[model samples]
Target chain A: MSAAPILAAFRQAFAEAWAGGAGALLPLGFLGGTAVLVPLGIGSDTDTLSAVGPGIIWVSLALSSLVTLERIFQADVEDGTLDLWLQTGAPMAGIAAAKTLAHWLAAGLPLALASPLLALMFQAQASLELLVHLGLYALGGLAFFFWGGVGAALSATVRRGGLLISIIALPLYVPTAIFGALAMTGGIGSDGAPMLLAASTLFACAVAPYAMAAALRLAAD
Target chain B: MFAGQGEQAKPLPVTLLTAPLLTARDLAILRGERVLFRGVGLSLSPGEGIVLRGANGAGKTTLLRMLAGLTRPEAGDVARAAPHHWIGHKEGIKPQESPRGHLALWAQAWGSKANIPEILEKMALKRAADVPGRYLSAGQRRRTAFGRLLLEERPVWLLDEPYTALDASGKAMLDAVISSHLRSNGAIIASMHDIAGFPVTAEVTL
Candidate 1:
């Protein structure tokens, strides 16, 4: 009935994402670590790095977000916060959305901010256009969490749901990953690709919450 | 300090013998292939407490969850006049945060007016107020979970194995809290292997 509870949940979820110190840094570390390993494995050829840079960044972002997916609702389920929320008469969908938003802020935002530096490591020069691309990646990251969160919610009853989450969510991530990579490499001229990516993000934002909420409700049962 | 607002200020005797606050009829639950329990019925009015007794694997926890509306029964109905509070086996404390931090979040979420410090003191967790939850002992964690009952004023409380890890003092504190809750016309349905320490008005064995 009141917005206060939902807002408080959002804040608490965000704080929880950073409470252990390690949670906030984990995605960034995974992204950066993966980016660093790319160049060492591949040859130092500039053209090769540039050609694969966008793909690598997209892949790293998806993987990193997946890495943190287990935290979205598992901790809440374990500690009884989920039960409390269900009892409070707050909409489960709203709580799921708030947690997903917080997850994006804590995990996705940092990855977006650090993407350019990671891209530069792969010899992709920084530019204003790169900022726009990174912003899209960040936006797409929110969608990633929303979609992956459904899997996380469904697997809430399962202890150590990391692998199950990946199995359930990775397939759902294909479209976003494809469109995001296309927009990244196709540059500013590929307006359709970015537009489609944005649309997917918006669609996921609208739909994932209900699906996640239902999954969580089932898990609680 | 205890009589602040809402139902807390009302005397329990006035609401006694009123309409049932919670009712469950012919509740049956099947876990996997096994029917854990069946034909369980209960009616709880204000100032009443029900202690669910059963041996190990007797579905005490399942019955509590079903009553709390967390789980659905295969065949039966549970009707409640108000939203109930539930404290399951899980402490629900975030290991990374302090007790005060966790309590603050819960209080805000539940819109509780209870004083946090007083609750911490009541639970005898004042000394461990700033310690991360993971560091808390089993007894301390159980006490912290019980502290949630004071934070929110709910008419019904569904507690599963509430005295599992409580020490002598903690168990005594729980008794006192439950008594006060009953005094305020609040109802409790607790599932326990033994109901020796509780003042239960009714008993249901599954």
Candidate 2:
């Protein structure tokens, strides 16, 4: 099919991400809150802070990724965009992927980019290694948002589905969380942790859209 | 004047109406374990219009959705020669989106190059074109919803309660458009309370 439908969905989603006032920056605020609280709650010991900093970032990222997902498909369903999409004859999976990816760029990407700074706030080093960790955060964040999108689509028709979305998505997030933390802490047999993390993200990217499409179809019914 | 096309769209004689563009036979639907309707049937040819009349609990919307291919019948089947334009009760306009922006987005999505300004003018939304949906009156939003009809040409139109929220002038505008579409060999199936001057060719009471 021509790229027009997908482009329209993407552009609309991208614009909606920023149109909600300060709502778009909510993830950043969430990450910033976690960054501030970690130092206060866990004490300011340098060794302990640096050791657990990466894991904290991943956990916070996973939690905050669910923030915007509840509204992703729910809004479309309410506003009747979902019905129009059903009639458009474009691949629903592609539209689902485009919408989720747009939301990721709006809400999830900033959380990933802010992780390095958040790591610094947790007392991690300013070495070149920080850049590598930044890359990992971006990939991990994408995986989280995509998986969360499945939950969002599934619960799109339910009223006040935020908590239900978290309940459904948290279990799916386990693999990415484990591998992401392991990749940072140099755990496991070899240098396979980062590869496993990348694989998890890739797998989510490939499969989440189809799952979302099926759920959205059911929601439309 | 809206029904007349210059030089082209040669008006076919009434007897030359083409084969049915949409047909449904023995259609049955259930809502919440209650049998809403069954053995329902409909057929539409070019330049034909069907009006569905029923009480509040009747299955008018369900039948419309079934014909539009949005809902599957429990026992029967629907055959469509082409896609349909479905305008449900929701109107589909986002609260933050203006009518102009909404139409522009739909034009791109449907890959239609219809003139946006002309469509807005036709819908009587020229004055409120750029105002956000939340600020528009119910009638204005319904008119914006009707704008999709002009965005692209579809063989069959499946409209549910299309006249709800339309003012007298808006209703008159709709009548003119519907007559124009019928003159061009387009078909329409609308679930409505009152015909309200629509040139309905057939009526189905659920």
Candidate 3:
């Protein structure tokens, strides 16, 4: 079977995910700000909000992952592109990874670009905070995309979406959401987050490709 | 009619001197609810054309998907002759990407390309080379995909309904192309709903 054809599928899938996600930054920005408004708008009764308000950026970023994932494989899945992709003689894992990368480029980059805006809106940054926030956001967002790929692939098969995706994906998000929040805290370095997140991210990343690919196989089957 | 010189020499592309293009045996798969196919065996010699036919859910497409290496069967040893083509209903063209760009990616992956223009002309897609796939009609898309086959010098073709959206002329064009491929002693395993024009000596149903 042809290998180039599969790579072609990968490149196209990546480009679509990136372009689609970046195209919708306005709403994502609003959502990010609202995440800030909750505690800041009400009061400081919440220690965790005052203490970990900064982490909301990752939450926003995580949701940004949800932002574009809904459409990840929908177009092609409907138009017969996914089946054609399977026709090409390449491992499904590679195809899944290429798409995940595309989602990050589209959704992750936008959140990073909007970091200063989010920081300023929340009054969360002091000095070099955007830099720290951006770094951690980049790492955490990438990890989130891996898991999202798995969700998107599985959800691609379902009839009713959104709710199911959130249900399936939300539980997984707690680990990432908590780990990401802890990682962004005031600290000298990555601490537990770097290793734990990297390891957790590793597991997510490692399993995502095969899992999504397998899901595609089942859906096609 | 368009198949190269090989079609004139023999009815089947198989030869004792050459290796069989593909071989598979004892292939099995298990899904969440039921078994898709079990103990599946397959082999195709050079220039051999095996048509997989069954009802919609009978696993024709699934079998092709597995042999194309999309999903490894749950239990089976599947092998292929180098330079095979598995064309499904996808047409595999990106709506945003132009025809040449789409074919260029295939050329890069399949290790075949004489000249883009010559190939497009052969497949009658030279005029649509610059257009994105979305703008093209269903026939044009299938033509462009078949153009990928022409540009790629592979010997084995695994096609699923190579006849989906083609006009009568387009169907004739496809039949001639496969005929020519066989002429060159290359094998084709096609899963088609309609197969009146081409020669199909074997059938595998799941």
Best by DockQ: 1
Give the clashing residue pairs of candidate 1, or none.
A79-B92
Between prediction 1 and prediction 3, which has the larger DockQ? 1
Q: Give me the runs in candidate 2 sitting further than 4 Å from their true place.
A: A21-23, B1-17
Tell me the TM-score of each prediction against the true structure. 0.93, 0.95, 0.79
Give lDDT tens digits, candidate 3, residues A125-208: 457866876776677777787887778788886765656666777677777777777776746554777567667777887888
The worst-scoring run of ten residues by lDDT in candidate 2 chain A lies at: A15-24
Q: Model 1, range A12-127, lDDT digits (tens) per residue?
A: 78878887546659989999899989989998999999899889998899889988888768888878778777766678788889988988888888989898888888788878
In model 2, state the lDDT of residue A207.
100
Error of 3 at A91 (Å): 4.1
- Judged by whole-model lDDT over C-alpha atoms, candidate 1 comes out at 0.83
Which segments of candidate 1 are over 4 A away from where they belong?
A187-189, B1-17
Candidate number that wins on lDDT, 2 or 3 = 2
For candidate 2, lDDT tens digit of each residue in A1-221? 57778888998888777775344589888888887898899899999998989889999999989988888899989988888877677888999999999999999878878877888887877888988988999999999999999999999999999999999999999999999999898866438999999999999999999999999988987
Give the winner by DockQ: 2 or 3: 2
> DockQ of candidate 2?
0.42
Chain B TM-score in each of the candidates: 0.91, 0.91, 0.86
